[model samples]
Target: MKRLVLVALVALALGGCATTAPYGNFVQPPVTVDQQQLAGDAAKQLAALWPPAKTRFELQQPTPDEFGAALVGNLRSSGYAVLEYAPQKASGAGNATPEQKDADPVVVVTPTTVALPLRYVLDHDAGTGLYRLTLLVGSQSITRPYLEQNRVLIPAGYWVRKE
Candidate 1:
């Protein structure tokens, strides 16, 4: 009975560690600037790591604001096909008319090629008056720091890319 109980306890502990989610969801903070220039710079750096035309990006986070918009635009301009995911609102608490359902039919695209999932983190340090933008693509990540002055952001240092 003692050995059986120990095995049960071990199984329970291992069960708690299992998770289905591929990655943790992080809240993206707002930025003061539109970040067009910064996004362009980041896009250029990312293009060096991954060829823009060859690689397709599926952005894992919603970009409802300026910085996200800028990043998406920049990535597109850099020849990347970026797909941003946004959750669809339930129609009237799941009671939708047939007409409504017909109007918005769910279209799923199964590409022959795999698109890399991309995530980004934009954080501001109040004490240092600096902004850090980190882009994570597949298993790699690149981070760059920026300093804001008079509504313009200047690069504080070189990008640090990590595999």
Candidate 2:
């Protein structure tokens, strides 16, 4: 009986040594996503346009950087080169001309507090089509078309997917 108890203790110790899954591994990362605000027809469409991880995209958080870290972490996991852009305040030009010539798109995350938890402002002017994003309860992200889009009708601005 003592030998059996020892074996059980060893098994328990081994199990404890196992590493726990990262926060992002879980569907809902201990965060809250309000659904009522996210509800509507356009949310699904935005989700579809949201850039996937692994791609090289520039990031500009104009808002209070609500999900900046969390988002970058997620994107990095997917093998994306998430570059942050902080244009020189002294320069009159908002974006450098040379950078604009590149094919890589710039991602803008602007939080619309008036509509947060329901929707976030995503600007990728370099990208092309209609884009939309809505955050639902249980941290669920529902998007239509079931894929990301490269060509959007609206290139830059804080507008939801109307079409």
Candidate 3:
């Protein structure tokens, strides 16, 4: 009886350790291009622009916190203002309370590819990691000519790079 109980306990413990959402650990499946195309397109659009002379960016994906932190660092280096991130928090049963009602304008980031590619090693072990991500730098003030000239907010395929 004692041995049987111990075995059952061990089995239960091991089963509990298994998980499905394997992030930050094992190498995930290969990320397809379709998953990350939008962000790539947005980045290409921003890269083509030469104005806003003093523009700012706000990232909204790959875990909003991580994106925001990186954007803040990048913008700071580029001499652009780094605005505060206002994460939407659950308010009640039906809606989310505004973390900051006067949140700054932001550009959203979306992970086109959620899985990582596999690599072959001497041991032939598989690994998981994140591949490229597609970001959309959208803003409500989509009027300025500089923004227009760069075709920043233009629909996809307007200036898609063929690489």
Candidate lDDT scores, in order, read: 0.79, 0.38, 0.34
**How many steric overlaps are in each model, in order?**
0, 15, 8
Error of 3 at 27 (Å): 8.6
Question: Best by TM-score, which number?
Answer: 1
Clash pairs for candidate 3: 26-128, 27-127, 27-128, 28-128, 35-112, 36-112, 39-134, 39-135
Over 4 Å off in model 1, which ranges? 1-32, 86-109
Q: What's the lDDT for residue 33 in model 3? A: 21
* lDDT, candidate 1, 1-163, per-residue tens: 9999999999998887684333321224544565777778889998998998899998887776566788899999889989887666665836877788678667788887788988877777778988888888987889999898887888999999888
| Whole-structure CA lDDT of model 2 | 0.38
Estimated TM-score per prediction?
Answer: 0.68, 0.27, 0.27
Candidate 1 accuracy as TM-score = 0.68
**Could you tell which candidate, 2 or 3, scores higher by lDDT?**
2
Question: Which stretches of candidate 2 lie above 4 Å from their native place?
Answer: 1-54, 91-163
Error of 2 at 131 (Å): 15
* Candidates ranked, most accurate by TM-score first: 1, 3, 2
* Collision pairs in model 1: none
Ranking by lDDT: 1, 2, 3
